[model samples]
Target chain A: MARHVDVGDLVDRARQRQPRAVARLISLVEDASPQLRDVAAALAPHTGRAQVVGLTGSPGVGKSTTTSALVSAYRARGLRVGVLAVDPSSPFSGGALLGDRIRMQDHATDPDVFIRSMATRGHLGGMAWATPQALRVLDAAGFDVVLIETVGVGQSEVDVVALADTTLVLLAPGMGDGIQAAKAGILEIADVFVVNKADRDGAETTVRELKYMISLGRREVRGASWRQPICKTVAARAEGVEEVVAAVAEHRRWTESHGEFAERRRHRARTEVEAIALESLRARLSARHGEALDGLAGKVMAGDLDPYAAADSLIADIKAEG
Target chain B: MARHVDVGDLVDRARQRQPRAVARLISLVEDASPQLRDVAAALAPHTGRAQVVGLTGSPGVGKSTTTSALVSAYRARGLRVGVLAVDPSSPFSGGALLGDRIRMQDHATDPDVFIRSMATRGHLGGMAWATPQALRVLDAAGFDVVLIETVGVGQSEVDVVALADTTLVLLAPGMGDGIQAAKAGILEIADVFVVNKADRDGAETTVRELKYMISLGRREVRGASWRQPICKTVAARAEGVEEVVAAVAEHRRWTESHGEFAERRRHRARTEVEAIALESLRARLSARHGEALDGLAGKVMAGDLDPYAAADSLIADIKAEG
Candidate 1:
């Protein structure tokens, strides 16, 4: 059933807080449908209003619990919230954890809350490409706050940092030490640190270690700013989560006062544009030059051309075709 | 210092088992030096002989230890080995674990063993872009086996699987279960599952659980005859390391006989070529059209143009300029 989607109508319903409309808009973004240009044109003005917070941590950390607690806290304050869980797994398998849904069941009936899971689906640079648009959809749908949660593994943490206004890096007592966190390259990107599962043993040790590590590292001064805070939370029991929320608010305020918020958003928009442009060019190249690419590869494999020269020739061919 | 490098001489020295020559060639690859095309051209005919094996597991799961043990085992067979440890952490920070080096001290002085650590360095798609060339350099330099070790965190595993002919997924007792492995999405990519720390409590349970899970999943038949094997190992003590090697050989034999080996290599080559081409296009776009990109992004941000439309316009501009 191919039909027209009225961008104006969708925007109106989204502004009116219609969950179905919001879901449809997000689906449009996820699918990268032909109407994506219209959807982006429609949603652009309504964005830059929602507070984007990113939550990430290694597997086995209480990211889901913390996210759930924060959602309830925001809902209690009468704010609309949206949660985007980026799953870096096979998209066809729907790898969204059942445990995550059960933990988030508290807000399942709350119309003010929208939770969506995005899978990588094996696309090249897929998560980084799709997330900004998804965030925009939620932001335009009138959510007061949007929380992006991702597994803090390798590049995903970097990707989340680029999209979030304030990023929270969660840790647990026995999940290695501050050095390991530093080794994971998350320490520098973290705006706030949460030692979740504080009710467990060695929470204090984790907190102390993180503080020591943070102290040793040189903090980049974007502007007149605040210090990154480390909070302890038993997210499962909803303890100390309010403190995390407060830290996020505090960071947001600091960024706004220092004029860094606008700067960050501008950088994000530029990055999103570049990613899309690159993807578009790649698609065009592949569609137009599939045979040429294979021929070049065959030559490279047969030692008739080096890969670098082959790449140069391919670029030249693309330009000539253009 | 900017003197010309003789690519043929470097390749000759590398084939003659000179570690300095191998290191220099790898540096050229990592830096994306202008001479990389010449280097690749010189090295192409000598490539594709090494058996590439990928070893990955979660942090603290004895991946480094297992890798060290396997290296020693391979060396005992009078085979030259190359180790490329992909650190997903900061490239500039050189966050490669001192423990990794200290553990592999046994082979540090062995001319036949070349160990190198590669960091992501904050580049876009850096690891995936750099690993293939690095592997090719090693393969062409006459290593009998090249072991690619990466932290089994999220997307890094997927990257490693693409470059390896066989992949070994390591697990330990008390580090969660087969379900956790499935959640991590490593179950499907693994050719061999190693229960490291087999002396620890619950080791038998981990092995059995992994076996049961592997049985339940539908394995893709890429070759004539092969079944994923589960092995138990105390890597620290070098126990069962030989069995892992034997399994790698068995998988290699199966793939070669079934023609999957050539097929996989062709796919790997195709992927590498595509990555290089894409990177080349991105560089060209940035160099030749920086202002155009910024202008498009500005338009998108100001709501005058949607990002998709802006991208289309940007592509059009590039084509026109070409």
Candidate 2:
């Protein structure tokens, strides 16, 4: 077993806005250490402060550049910031490419900025399983803003919306059209849409298409009252990034004024709690009922039992064990 | 409650190769109807016969066209084929756009060719939860080959590999370089690489880059003895598609000769069983522990308890209730 981390010391240091301490707490959560329960208990009181913002787009759509620009803008406001990049490519250690790391090196030396990448290696639940805990660690660490970046690819990647108070869906010229956006389901999760690389040709066309798509009212409006704002940004040059940041802040204001802020956070908390409980039950079931499960699988394979019937029997066995 | 579906009648009709019966069985799996257990029990013996092949790529990578061509090729071989298009855009029903539906009209009238679209609307587990059951339905319904087609954009879309005997990763020229392929992790999941749209510019470059990447030996090499083959196809004109089909058959032969076929199926069965059990436990937990869960969520929200601790408490309560 790994040596026990000192939860109290870590909490105290994190409360003091120490990036190393915050990173350590997140590492514990990522590793799922035995002391995670104690760490969670220690940090609970300090959370629910940071505004969680999610940035997602198709790969090569300048998500990182836009994220970096947003970070700089937030830091310019003299607020502490935390970045959690859920990297699908590297699911083992949450490793970022050297180029990506160098791109964000502007904030690397700042003590008020904490950046961490999380890998989804063993997480079958995808971002739904690991992200909320990491967000809590950053939230408790006194960051005023937390930026969660994930590559928009498939269904589970959209879960970032569940964790963020504001979600920016990024697009670039020549990537695809409004039909592709609608097909990818990004329109549904986006609170603010950012058209990056605005200097490129067809930028205006992309903007027009996005505006038309938003006007369609096909997206499942979360709050039903907030109209999503579309902003164009040349993030590489830091142009229009401030406008994007301002739109995010406007969303925050809207949600708060409408009393959706607390409601959203409460819902997020409930989801996190439920996910944790479900994972725990699954872990216990596998650990204790390994043989029985194997037996059930054998029967299913042999056509003596269906998977549903086998599942019912397995659940019964777990209940009986309890 | 919906009336119980007659498992025996459905199975008999499906086994007789009735498209309506197969469709109904898949609908039950998608709706997660109560009679699904009986259906699975009846279908269990009839599965492990059809070859499950999964074709996935980014949107606009010609997945549907390639799928249609492959269906035609299999039909030419006098083999019945079933196509399941997991449409992300249409969540309520597994409905395809008119254009896509029309593209497959050639096979639509053939009774031996059963094509169904599955919506991922409410499924949080992605393909892991529903695709296997649907595959079982088709497999039991006497299809010689089941083509699983998904718009591969994100992480969870990779789950199709778990249910496929052979997974074909499709790419098109002008999409990107091998680096983008590596970033998407498609290279790892691909048992065979199909450079679709080979008539387009940079097709040779795409094929060469993919060959170089595969030569790097980065993929896990599942069976360890057989090397992945890269094939090029202009799926639109049906050129080179037969070669792709030949590659798929070669792979199947290799796996069978190496005894990897049965091994892969067994592994798939184990994963399917575990997922079902986990889903069942979650449903039961919500049904039985609603109030306790709500209380725990309240505590977590109020900061009186951390989510991890609350999750522990919730699990203990569940055990105690049992």
What's the distance in Å from true for residue B80, model 1? Answer: 0.6
Query: Which residue runs does candidate 1 get wrong by more than 4 Å?
Result: A1-3, A91-93, A219-226, A285-288, B1-3, B91-93, B219-225
Q: Give the DockQ-based CAPRI class for model 1.
A: acceptable
* Model 1 Cα lDDT, one tens digit per residue, A188-291: 77889999989888889989988887776644423424677999999999999999989999998988888888777777777787778777766655678778
Alpha-carbon shift of residue A315 in model 1 (angstroms): 2.7
- Docking tier of model 2: it is medium
* Interface RMSD of every predicted model, in angstroms: 2.7, 2.9
DockQ of each: 0.47, 0.51
Worst 10 residues of 1 chain A by lDDT: A217-226
lDDT of 2 by residue, B125-216 (tens): 64667888999999999899999998775666776565789999998886666655665666767888999988889989988988876766
lDDT for each candidate structure: 0.80, 0.80
Candidate 1 clashing pairs, residues 3+ apart or interchain:
none
